[model samples]
Target chain A: MIDIQLSERQEKIIDIVKANQPITSEEIAKRLSFTRATIRPDLAILTMSGILDARPKVGYFYSGREAMSFFTNQINSMKVSDIKSLPIVVDEQTTLYDAIVTLFLEDVGSIYVTSEGFLTGVVSRKDFLKNSIGGVDLNKIPVGVIMTRMPNIVTITPEDSIIDAAVKIMEHQVDSLPVIEETVINNKHGYKVIGKISKTNIVRVFVDLCKNN
Target chain B: MIDIQLSERQEKIIDIVKANQPITSEEIAKRLSFTRATIRPDLAILTMSGILDARPKVGYFYSGREAMSFFTNQINSMKVSDIKSLPIVVDEQTTLYDAIVTLFLEDVGSIYVTSEGFLTGVVSRKDFLKNSIGGVDLNKIPVGVIMTRMPNIVTITPEDSIIDAAVKIMEHQVDSLPVIEETVINNKHGYKVIGKISKTNIVRVFVDLCKNN
Candidate 1:
């Protein structure tokens, strides 16, 4: 894929096409006082880029497709699994202090809480700090006691697009999301935390996009 | 700007140009068993998109420019000031408790510290969480006692690109950066906090790019 800036004449051609739908190249050229050969390349670019649709005998029609659609397509094609990081999970019985320690040790923004190897809740540094300042005994309280519980946590599956993950993070005002897969634990349904996506991850992807470009 | 996926024949034309660079259009057409007239549109596209360069009477040469260069240019053109949020700031004498309160009240990941309207330090949720768990007297210690002080804080000017901000955030492993402008405060050279760019801002930009596209 390649991106190109439209020349002035090409822009004029689009304007002309918009003003006169199904206009033939000859008419377009005549309108601009240029011969058909002079504008053929411009027409080719506009049509090839999908800005203009050319029917066999129907001349040109505006397609209304923007150039940035390529950017959107590229982002949408990236799956969460392609960029997710390993989630830091702690058992429900683990003390808040231990969980916080794990967060520090792993340098992760949030920790996933699991009960019997299935996702139950999530705790972030904000949650930990809020509780820490509230005079709670970090060593006595279980991490699950302070977590945002299941069904309330915003999550994404590996199959979801990274754009979907980014949207959830922004809309929910959360720092990170757990990438999970639905599972059956014994007789009950649950989600197994498999990966993690955070604002940091999103930023990394953004940097990488620019870097690779 | 527009992005386009090269057609099969267009791709073949590029391959031919790469191998026989400086070859004329007529020669390229002969190799592909097509008339020059039939390949004119493809040559126009390859040359216009900068994937191939055509010199008058000298034929075409591989430009070696990738399509994503447009994406890179678009991102680099965005200035930090274009999207930086109002900085959440606190005075040096404000107690850690009050700083934490400000952090919550503003719902920002980090808070900038100022002394006489000049940036002096920065404190993040992680710092607060660490001190909160350390048995420190949050109500007694001033934020200046715990913040990552000047010269240590990674900062950006308003003129810096948002890409620069993202790179610094990722490299420093920090949640946010203070947008600062140099100033003279009581004859001491320092930076005055102007705005802030955080992981959240980066995510928002990423989302907006996809949305706009």
Candidate 2:
């Protein structure tokens, strides 16, 4: 793939085609006060780039394909697994106070809670802060009690695109998502947390996109 | 601007040019076993897209410009002011408990602290959770006592590119950056918080990029 910055005359040629499509090259040349030969190369570049469509006997037609289509294609090709990070997981029996310590040690925004080795819930710093300040006995209560449980928690899978993850993060207004995989533990259907995709991960991808470019 | 997916013949032409520098079009056509007229359009597209350079007599040279340059250009053109959100600011005298309430109310990742209307410090959810569990009297202590103070906070200006902001956020390992401008108040030189760019903002930008495309 290659990118081309269109010249002023080429841009003007596109405008002419958009306004008077199906008009032959001779008419386009006449409008710009140039001969057919002088504008042939411009028409070739436009059609080859998919910005204009040409028929055998007809003139050019504007295709309206923006330069961003290439960017969109690149972004769509990146999967969630490509950028996901390790999830901080804890057992449901772990006390809230202990989970908070794990959050600090890992320096992550959220933690995944598992029961019987299957995903059950998720808790974030906000939840910890709210409960801690509300005079809850952090040592006595289990993390499972305060977490946003399954069916309510937003999630993503490894096959999902990074753009899908970003959309879920924005639409759900959550800091991160638990990347899960379908599983059955003792014949009970559940999801097992495999990875995590957060706002931080998305930001990192954005930076890499520019740096790599 | 336009994007072009190079044809198979164009790809072969690039490979040939990279292997043999200053190779004339006649030589290129001979290697491909095609007449010069047959590959003229392919060569025209390659040179126009800047992937190859054609000299008067020296033939063709590989330019090595990738398709990603357009992506980089779009990102660099976006300024912090274009996507920055409103900053959540609190006075230095505000109590830690009150600040936490403000944080929860605004649902922001970090809060900017101002002393007499100039940025002085910053605090995140981690800081709040750490202090709240450390036996500190949340209602009695001022927010200034625990904030990451001036000269230590990462900041961005309105004119800085979004890429620069993302770079600083990743490098500093911070959740957000306060958009500031130089100011003088009471003979004190300091920054006045104008807006904020956080991971959320970057993620939103990422989503918008794909959506707009």
Candidate 3:
């Protein structure tokens, strides 16, 4: 739900903390030219909402770490499938050069490489460097050789929590996770590439959650 | 060059094509459900703006393959300074449990592990899984054993472009890049532990850019 309750003054204060956090309360009051007393309640409410972060003897600042807290607390918590990007996929036969072109063209950082409709491997930009940098003939080489083959692929289901995906990203350190429905590419629609969850998407959600919670 | 000359409808049409690109003119017509006559001028203007994309017989889409193109344009053009995140550093003596807490608290996918103020190993969730999980001792172990050690580390400079980082991510198949200001960790607050750029940050940029562009 949108926060329609915070006063304009409070909103500005929240924005200020977000813009330059890890700042002192006294410093914030001095720079904004507001009295410490006047800023207290705003800070208090914002902190309670998970927007402002306060540590004893450390003063106050905006919390970038607040997202997970809010997610664990609020959000009415929806299924990851309720809101995920449909993944973009490519075939093993796709040339390295074309895969790079496709990655940029589709505005994605990774591509799922398949063979005969089975999840064979995934070709991401991370794998492209050793293979694509020099004038290696991208047209002649198939994406198969450079992919992280399946049975070892990291994936998530639609029913999982968003934080679950976020954890996978940090743990696995991959940019995106293909939200699979049994088989990601072999789904009924050929659009089996349904729902992608990227770290940036999580961050945006983090920002929003921080502001409101 | 900014695309400011196109009319609102033309821009809208271009956005629509981009949203579900690799689509045919007929399919684009179906999604927006626009008439052939209504979409003609918009397509023409987008083509004039160098925003048009087409397959030999596959109909139309948006083009962002160049510097001004959607996916690669901004990241490709971004200087390393713009997108790097604030860094969180941990001394080599820190325990694995502490690193886990810091990792979760900071919301970053990885943590830079330094020894005597120089670039050393990097500890990520993957490392934790390999070393920490399935073990009887969870809190006592050090992260150094599981980290990607210094000389083996791949990094980018604070001066590089986001595209360069993207290429690294794709090429090296790593989750995040540490923005190095030199292997030195300075005493001055201004220079130490400068920034980090994660794959998640890139996803956020693309989502917003896709919407507005």
Candidate 4:
């Protein structure tokens, strides 16, 4: 799914540099039996795109760790369905204290609130901190009392791009987003939670790409 | 610099969708006077890459904003030098109380601590919170005593990829990183702080890309 267009000659150039870096364009052209003038545009394209680096006296070298650029391509082409993780869901009736425990036990930054399997709201560490610092009884207060409700909660669909999901996560300043699907529940408009996207997911993607590459 | 490669035909398809969305693959093929079979692959590439989406019976529609995908490409190819913000610095001798005041007054999540213009340590919101919650005297404590010191603080060089910066931010779980250049100061090994990279920079890049696109 990589959308970056690298011609055969250009890719071969990258391969050569990876094998023996700090090689000059003249040396590269000689290796390929092509004139430097013929291969100059390829070098320019690669360098301009940050795929290669050229130092005045040091010559051209393969950019270290090109995996991130690869991952970026993957993320743009990828759908939320490709990388979303299962959400930690709780009932709205769950106490704030219980939700806090769940968050810690699950090692999650946020929890989805549900009623009859319909996404109702979301509670996060920030929310818990806000509520707890106010001296409200965590055990007596239900999660529904302080949770960010639907329509206000930023969400993503399975079909959405992972890049879109990343932007949503940042723009909303939420650690996680519930991947939702619209459904008719008792003839009322509602959304069913299907997956979750978080900053950790993006980090994991980058790590995996780096490792694999 | 956007590194993602969109074919001329794919670019044309995107332009067509931008002008008249909810366009079908068949219609696009007709507009180009090409067979559906000839155009099907192009449509698939565009949709799979998230520039366009198809609904059950609704044909194809432009995804609300493809700017983030474009920005992701831009960020991946971009060097840290291309987008880093100026560093907010404080001296090591600065008091904890003054540090806290500066943190809020500057509206920054973290500040770099310097010794004669060489980066020595970093103070973040979490660091301030941890130090403050201990009920210690903020007026008496120096930031150097509580700040995260170098060699332990994650840093990025200007030539590194922005993706590398993003990875460092996530891996260290720090809100920001001091952009540094290795230097010698009075016969001591140190780094000259030139810039800073933060989650906000990435978000700002995305926002700017969207606005411009």
Q: In order, what fnat does every candidate score? A: 0.79, 0.76, 0.03, 0.07
Interface RMSD list for the candidates: 2.2, 2.6, 18.9, 10.9
Residues B1-213, candidate 4: write the lDDT tens digits: 224456687778888887887878888888878887666656655665567888867678888655344335655678899989988899999998888778767767789999987898998765665455355788899999998897798999999987788778777777788899989878888799999988767555543544344
Stretches > 4 Å off in candidate 1: A6-68, B6-34, B50-68
Greater lDDT among 1 and 4 belongs to: 1
Return the number of clashes found in candidate 4: 0
Clashing pairs in 1: none
RMSD of each: 3.9, 5.0, 21.6, 18.7
Model 1 sits at a Cα RMSD from the real structure of 3.9
Tens-place lDDT per residue, model 1, A53-160, is: 999887999998765556677788999999999999999999999999999999988999999889999999999999999998999999989999988999999999
**DockQ per candidate, 2 decimals:** 0.58, 0.50, 0.03, 0.05
Clashes of each: 0, 0, 18, 0
Candidate number that wins on TM-score, 1 or 3: 1
TM-score of chain B of each: 0.85, 0.81, 0.62, 0.65
Model 2: residues with Cα > 4 Å off, grouped in runs: A5-68, B5-36, B50-68
Extract clashing residue pairs from model 4.
none
DockQ-based ranking:
1, 2, 4, 3
What's the lDDT for residue B135 in model 4?
Answer: 54
DockQ of 4: 0.05
In the range B65-120, model 2's lDDT, one tens digit per residue, is 66455667778899999999999999999999999999999999899999988999
Positional deviation of residue B195's Cα in model 1 after best superposition, in angstroms: 0.7
| Cα shift from native, residue B209, model 1 (Å) | 0.5
DockQ of 2: 0.50
